[model samples]
Target: MAEAAPERVYTEQEVEAYLGENLPHWKLERGWIRRTYRTHSWKSTLMVVNTVGHLAEAAWHHPDITASYAWVEVRLATHSAKGITDKDFALARKIEDVVCWQPGREGGPLEGTPAGDPRFAYIKYDKT
Candidate 1:
């Protein structure tokens, strides 16, 4: 038999503590945890949406995605449980990894992102 998926609903404290350490930009609110990724242009927004689309589809767990001119917000919660669950946390990490991806890394193809272009660089994180 296939292993069952984790159904444990994370307490508010657990959600805050884990997202605080791992996904600093994500915030808990309205019984959900979410983050909005700012992009440089409409094209960048499209790229972010497409990336999230594929990831969510592959994981078989989707979040409410809102894409606008230069930003995309992803919200996650286990609707069945009326709260967050381990699956939400797992997928959130995967989304973060790809959403903040840098070029030349093993990730979603940068076909739309211009080659070696500095303007495409969104908020740069220290290379620490």
Candidate 2:
């Protein structure tokens, strides 16, 4: 029987190149990949968390998730590698697909926010 090759820790240049033109919503932070999904209410927050939980379980790669009334922040890294790896990016892409899904909207993504959606307006990240 052959043993599986160990996963290599990604160089910053390799990671950046892989992201290419479609950066999605993830950001690199201190060796981790992080993203925060802001929702309109507690229900939406719970939905995101639950969906992520299921996906992570199936992927066998878990993330540090912080859930709040109007947001769910996820931080992903390959803990075994002590840094980000392909697994983090793969899972991040899956999460983004779930986030953009629209169950009954004819395949288009769900609307983001209205002109004055308070939940979207108050997040300080919005300023940047």
TM-score of each: 0.79, 0.75
Best by TM-score: 1
Error of 2 at 13 (Å): 2.8
Candidate 2 ranges beyond 4 A from true positions: 103-128
Residues 1-128, candidate 1: write the lDDT tens digits: 99776589989999999999988888899899998888777887888888988999999988999988878889999888789998788889999887776665546665444556868655333243
Question: Residue 38 in candidate 2 has what lDDT?
Answer: 79
Taken over the whole model, the C-alpha lDDT of each candidate is 0.82, 0.76
TM-score of 1: 0.79
Candidate 2 per-residue lDDT over residues 51-95, each given as its tens digit: 999999999999999998989999998998887787988898898
Off by over 4 Å in 1: 1-6, 104-128
Candidate 2 at residue 92, lDDT? 87
lDDT, candidate 1, equals: 0.82
